[model samples]
Target: MDLVITILVLLLVVALSGAVVRILPIRLPLPLLQIATGALLARPFGLHVEFDPGLFFLLFIPPLLFADGWRIPKRELFLLRGPILALAVGLVFFTIVGVGYFVHWLIPTVPLAVAFALAAVLSPTDAVAVTSITGHATIPPRLMHVLSGEALLNDASGLVALQFAVAAELTGHFSLTTAAGDFALTALGGVAAGVFVSAAFGVVRRRLVRWSSEVDPASQVSLLLLMPFAAYLLAEHFGVSGILAAVAAGMTVNFTDVSKGGYVATRVQSVAVWSMVEFTFNGLIFVLLGMQLPGIVGNAKLDLAQAGGGELWYLAAYVAAITLALIVLRFVWVWLSLRFVLMRALHRGEQRPKVGTRLMWTAALAGVRGAITLAGVLSIPLMKAEDVPFPTRDLMIFLATGVILATLLIGAIGLPLSAKKLKLPGEDPRVKEERMARALSAEAALRGIAEEQKRVEETRDEKAIALASRVAARVVGDYQQRLEAAGEEGDVPEKARAEAGTERIMRLAALRAERRELFDLRRSHRINDETLRALIRELDLAEASLTGLHAE
Candidate 1:
């Protein structure tokens, strides 16, 4: 009962946080608001929540990472692959070495391997937290894509590095050659596992759907929801990177052409369900972080006192120093990368894109550490051996959590200031491409409609011919207008576009009226529940057609 209550309460808080965000005068990101709310629950109200670290990681990280992989623009990821790889792989190693040395020097009590472990957890930026902090439109689209791509790949690398670091700490041994082989095996195996599982599932699901006359949207959605977990567990079972597996599964799903026909409800339900899942999981993680904050600090103080060494104030300075070090390191790396690009551009005799100070700072500040950091830090074992607590476990947790909070705050403050009013140079060709696609599709639709009309004429019944002609004219008028509007010729007048807008407005108004009338009928007991649902669905489909038609 207590466990159930805890879950319900957490969910309630998550839901309420959205409302509170609107009501608050000062703008705070929802993640920050959720965390503050959790802290409130923990500090004054004595709310306590705990779980096995392995289970916590298993529950929240895979689905969130999978969602990121699914939704991030694959084109941008591929185009920016060079820079993204630099940040994701190269910068992770850079931070691991630099921050590892800094932490060890600052606090000699922390072993070198343990310092590297701390740095490893901190290196992976939380692009989700950044997105929440700054809306996508606020950041330059290309830079946002790079940040997202980096976040997607680095989580796996950071966590894998942490595992090796932790092993070294335990056994007092380290080997670059063995680690390199293990890393390759782990990453490659994870990708292979994810591709295989997702591909196999896609094949089986496609066959089953084809064999059956009917499809169950609920079952299909359930299977989709299980996909990330399946990939994660399979890779973990094989002693590989579960994080990469989950990511690979999501990216594979995006590439797979499983939504070709007659699966509209399945796709719709999948979108709605996955949206809810992402929000709930993300909210719960931050809220849990908030709840744990008070305990983490108190325990760290005790650990320090018991160790008979460090002062209480040293903790704050440590967090501040680490956070600053990370920011400086990131800034320097980004600056260096830009310079390297400038040199290459000059060498190739190409126009050098103007490098702005604000852009580099925005890129640096956007590196907000989030849930993955929290989970990895928390998962550090409590005991090194029987009757021996892991050295400075609480202290490390305190430091990592503190750094997460610090980075979030810095990003919240700096990103907007740095990124404001900046324009990226390259034009997105998607607009032109979409217009062309619409024109082509409209032409093809016109041909199909004309062919069907001709078939109707062949029926050779006068009344049928008359009805077919009227219907074809009505449908063909819309497509003809659509083709003109979308065509490259650009000869269509502004008035024609304005009229099309008016028609859409009228159609949307009629859809809303139908919805209201159907609901009124239901309320007056004139329509059965089943009939009401059918009517409402029809209205919803019509409304959907009007809205988000051009959305990417």
Candidate 2:
């Protein structure tokens, strides 16, 4: 009961924090604010929550990665492949090697393997942090794609490296060749598993859609939600990278309406359901992070003081040094790589443009770490072989926490300032592309209506045909207006758009009134719950369409 109550309270806090952040005059990053709120609620309030490392990985990561893969702009991802790979794979290994040595040299008490383990923990940037910061910001699509793609793939690489390092520590040995071979096999195997799982699920979903009369949207949504966990667990069971498996599963599922009759309700309901889950899960993770601070700090203090009174200062200095190194190294690598490696390849035939210094800085500042890093560090076993406490475990947690805070601070302050200073492209080309696509779709819809009108005319019943043609003409007129409004040429007038928006609101109010009447009827026993639900679903779909059309 206490545990359940604690979870409810934490969720309430998450909800309230989201509302509060939105109403603030100066918009702050949501994840950072949640972290601060969690920290505050931990002490004085005496809110204590324990999160198991294994459960944390299982419950939180798969869905987050899956959603990222599902939503990532595939076209942009392909175009930015070179830089994404350079950062995701190349920079990750570089950090593990470079920072691993740096940490080992700084703290002689910590083993080289443990140092590498810490590096691996910090290597992958957090996708949640990147999206939270850049979601509203006017950044280039290519840059956002690179950051997102890197976050998705690097989780697998970083975790694999961490596993090898831990294995080396336990055995008191290390092998470069074996580790490299295992890493390649794990990545490839994970991708294959994910593809297989996704394809299987895709067939099932399509079959269910074909049998729509026997299945409801709720059941379909429930099944869709299980996909990520299934892929992750299956890959893990096969001794492969679960993170990559989840990501690939998300990417492989065909969410678009390519089939003759796509599952509209399923798609719509699944998006809403997943979005809510993502919000709650992400919020809880950051809040849990704050709750862990008191214990982490206490452990670090005791461990460092036991080493020597002066060693506390050394620990602090190391944290600062590592945090600074992460920032500096990322900037240098991005700048140098883009100018030399990527540019040369692009000149040969790649479609990407040469990355400039401004974009490089943007990417560097965007390298913020969050929940994943904390989870990795905290997952370090408390005891290793012979029941001895894991070497530097406390210190590693402390350092990881410090790095997370440092990067968040840097990102929150630097991202906006750099974006402003650089005058990075504020306009998203995708917005224009979406508008054009909608216009084309509306034109096609009009043509379909015209064909229906022609068919009705062939019935040759004057009265019935006249009524049908009038309705068709009205629908065609609406589509024609929408098609003209979303013209491909020049910008629409702000006043006209605002008026159209106002008109939409008026129409929505009328729909809502109708919905209220239907609910009232159900409450009064004039209609059954089943019928009410069916009618409500229609209203929900209408509202969803209106909301989507207006979303920019």
Candidate 3:
């Protein structure tokens, strides 16, 4: 009961923080606000929230990664694969080497292996942080794609590095050749596992759909929600990288096709379900991050005191130095890579897009660390041997938390200002492509109507011929209107766009009225529930199409 109450209270805080962020004039990011709220609750109010690393990983990480993989633009990810690999794998290893040595030099008490462990903890950028910062900004799509892809893949690499570091520390030995082999095996195995699992699930789902009279959308969505967890657990059971498995599973299962078929309810319900899950899970993670501060700080202080130096300021300075190093290193690496590597690669092709200085800075600043870092740090065991605490565990957590906070602060402040300063264009080519696709679809529908009208005319049924003609006329009119709206004119007058918007609003109002009337008819037994549902589904689809058509 207490646990239940605590959960309810945390959810309430998440909801309230979401509302506050939107309502406030300052336009603070939601993660920053939620973390502050957690800190406040923990400090003055003595609100204690225990950290369970296992449970956290099980509940939050899989779904988050799955959703990212599902929604990521696959084409852009492939196009920017070079940079994504550079950042995700190359930069992560670079940070581990650079920060590992830096930490060892700063704190002689910390061993090199343990230093690498700390570096590994701080290496992977959080997807939540990246998405939240980029979602509202007008950054280029390719940049966003690279960032998203890097975040998704680097989690697995960093965690795998951490696993090796931890094992070396425990065994009092390290082997480079063995580590390399293990990394390859785990990473490759993870990918294979993900592909196998996703394919099996897809086959099963299709079979179920084929055999069943009607598969409930809610049940199908429930199965989908389980997929990430299943993939993760299966890969883990085989001693592979579970994080990568979850990501691969998500990318493998193409929900877009499923959503386009007769599974309208599944599409609609799944969107709402996943959206709610992301909101609640991400909110609680950040808030709980803040709540962990008191315990982390106190532990670090106690450990330092035992080591004969209890200067909290010293630890703060150390965290600050490492945080600064992360930012500076990332900036330099990205700039050099763009200047030397990416430019040369692009020179091979005509009409290649060039990366500018501003874009490099944006990418560098966007490396905000969040939940995954904390999870990695906390998962570090408390002791190495009987009655002996893990070396520098407390300090590592303290520094990891500091890095998370520092990066978030830098990203939240820097991203938008840089975007505005760069005068980045907001136009998306995909929007134009979508409009063209809709116009073509409308044209196809018109052609189908015309063909049907010709067939009806040959039948010599007067009523049917008249109905066919009327439908064909309506289809032609709709097609023309859509094609005109999608035209590449010199400019569309603002007044015309306004009128089109107003017309859409009026059409939506009429659709809603028709739905309400159908509901009333069903209630009055003038129509059966099945008839009402079928009509409502049509209305819902119509409204969705109209809403999507005009949405910016």
Judging by lDDT against the true structure, name the best candidate. 1
Using lDDT as the yardstick, the better of models 2 and 3 is 3
- Cα lDDT of candidate 2 equals 0.80
Candidate 3 lDDT tens digits, 1-552: 877887888899999998898788876778779888888888998888775556677778888878877777777788889889999899999999999999888887788999999999788997567667655667666677788888877877887799789888988999899899988998898887877778887778788888997778888899889988999999999999888888888888884345557887798888889888878888888788778777878988886776668577988898889999998889988987777675676687645556677877888898889777777777887778999878878888888988888888778888877765665555676676777787688678777777888889999999988887887787776566665666554355344445567879999999999999999999899999899989998998899878877463
* Candidate 2 lDDT, 1-552, residue by residue in tens: 999999999999899988998888876777778877888888878899876667777888888878878777777778888888899899999889889999888777788999999999899898667666654566666677788889877876787788788878878988899888888898898888888888887678668767765546787678768889999999999999888898888887754321226557666777888888888887887788777777777888876766555555676687889988888889888877867775676788877655567777888888899766766777677778776888878889889878888888778878877765555455567777877897889988988988888888898999989899788878876776677667655465344455567868988998899899999999899999999999998988888778778443
TM-score (all chains, Cα) for each model: 0.93, 0.89, 0.89
lDDT of each: 0.86, 0.80, 0.81
* Selected candidate, larger TM-score, 1 vs 3: 1
Is 1 or 2 the stronger prediction by TM-score?
Answer: 1
Q: Output the lDDT of residue 259, model 2.
A: 20
Task: Give the per-residue lDDT digits (tens) of candidate 1, residues 22-53.
Answer: 88887677777887889998999989997877
True-vs-predicted CA distance for residue 138, candidate 1, Å = 2.9
Q: Number of clashing pairs, model 2? A: 0
Instruction: Show where candidate 3 strays beyond 4 Å.
Output: 134-137, 255-257, 307-310, 342-354, 423-426, 451-460, 490-499, 509-545, 549-552
